[model samples]
Target: MNPIDTDPPPPTACFTYGSLMCEDIMAAVCGAHAAYRPATLQGHRRHAVVGVAYPGMVPNADHRVQGVLYLELPDSAWPRLDAFEGEEYERRIVTVETDGGAHAQAWTYVFRPRFAHRLAPADWDFDHFLRVGKARFMADYVGFDTLQPR
Candidate 1:
C-alpha cells in the first residue's frame, strides 16, 4: 500500500509589482489565485526589463514601487510562479505600505544581480503595462516549461 502525503500549507501573501499585478495574468500563471490589496513597497524601484514586457525590482533608497499584496495564495501556485519567474528573479521578504496606513510583510520577486544589466533605468509603469504590454505577454511570454518533469 502507498502512503498518503499531505500538501504544504498555502501562502498567505506575496507583493506583486509586475505583470502578476494583473488578475487575469495571475489566474493564468497560478490557476485560481488569491486576494490582492493595494500596496507600495518602499526602498525599491520597478524597472522595465529590456526585450520583455514585464518589470523587475531593484533596491533604491529613496524610491517606492506601487503594486498589490496577494493573499491566500494556493500552495500549487508557487511552483508555477517560481518557474515562471525563473532564475532572473529571486523571491525575498519586504514590507509594504498600504493606503490605510498599514504596513505588512510580504514576499516579492526582485531582479537577480547578474540580470541587473537587463533592467532599464526608467521606472516601469503599471498602468502603461496594462495598456501596452499585457496583450503581448499573455500571448507570448515563455511559461510552463519549468513545471515539466526533469
Candidate 2:
C-alpha cells in the first residue's frame, strides 16, 4: 500500500522506528503524556549501523520491519520530528498492524533515494539505544530551544 497521505486533521498518530522509539525522544517531541503501542509493518527491513543510535529501514528483499505505534499528538509535534530528522528523511504514510490484528494509519520516516545507497546497517542495539541514545537525542532536541533557531 502507498501509505503517504496529506496531513490528517488535528489529532493524528505516527509510527516511529528510529530514535523516536526512545521514550525521551517521544517526550521531547510529543510531550510526556504522549502514548504509544507496539506495532509492526510488513515488507520492510530494519538494519543496524555504526555511528547512529537508531536503526535504518531498507526495502526488505524478504521480510517486514517491526516498530512502535505512537498515539496521536498535537499538530505542534510535527515540526519537532521534522527538525530532529532533517531533510534526509521523508515522512511517509504507513499502515501498521497491532498484535491484536487491528490496523492503523501513521507516519514514518523513510530515507530519500539520494541517501538510500549510502545507508548502512543501523547498528541498532536496542538495549543501548533505549538506554543511551534516547537520552542523547532528547538532550540535543530540547537543547535547541527553537526549531527554526535564531
Candidate 3:
C-alpha cells in the first residue's frame, strides 16, 4: 500500500501588465503580498481600454509589454484574479524576460480579440497610470468590491 500525495503543486509565476502591476493593487486582489521581478513580454502591445483607467494587452509582433513578474502566486489567488479580469480578458501562458536577462514562463491575462474595438489606438502609458490613473482606478473600480471567494 502507498500513501497518497495530497499537497497542492507549487505555484507558478504571473505576468501583470496593467493595474495588477501595482503592488498595492496586487496585494488587495490576492489577499496577500507576493514577490515580483521586473519583466518584459515580447510580441505584445498594451493599450488603454476605452473609457477605462487600466490597460489591456494584445498580440503585436512588433511590440513588447513591460510588466512585473509576480513569483509563485498561491493557487488560491487565481479565482480572484480571473474574476477581476472579467469577460474581456483570458489568462494564457507566455514567456517573459526579466530585467536580469533571464527567461521564465508565466501566466498572463490577455485582452480578448472580440474586445479589440474597446482598445484605444494609442499605447497605454504606465507612467501616466502611476501618476494619474492609479487613484481613480483604486477608488472607482468596482471589481475589487465584487470578488467572490473560491
**Ranked candidates, highest TM-score first:** 3, 1, 2
Who is ahead in lDDT, 1 or 3?
3
The TM-score measured for candidate 3 stands at: 0.89
For this target, which candidate reaches the highest TM-score against the unseen true structure? 3
lDDT of 2 by residue, 1-150 (tens): 344766554337787777777666577555444778888888777666445556667566577766778887777777777776676678788788977889988888777667665567553556777778766656555654355411
- Candidate 1: 10-residue stretch with minimal lDDT: 141-150
Ranking by lDDT: 3, 1, 2
lDDT score for candidate 1 against the true structure? 0.82
Residue 54, model 2, lDDT = 61
Per-candidate count of clashing residue pairs (backbone under 3 Å): 0, 7, 0
Cα lDDT of candidate 3 equals 0.89
Residue range with the least summed lDDT across 10 consecutive positions in model 3: 1-10
Model 1, 31-120: lDDT tens per residue? Answer: 766878899989998999998899999999999998989887877777777888889989887888876789977778999989998998
Which model, 1 or 2, shows the larger TM-score?
1
> Tens-digit lDDT track for model 3 on 85-144?
889999998999999999998899999999999999999998998899999998887468
Provide C-alpha RMSD values for all models, in order: 5.8, 5.1, 3.7
Using all chains and alpha carbons, the TM-scores for the candidates as numbered come to 0.85, 0.76, 0.89
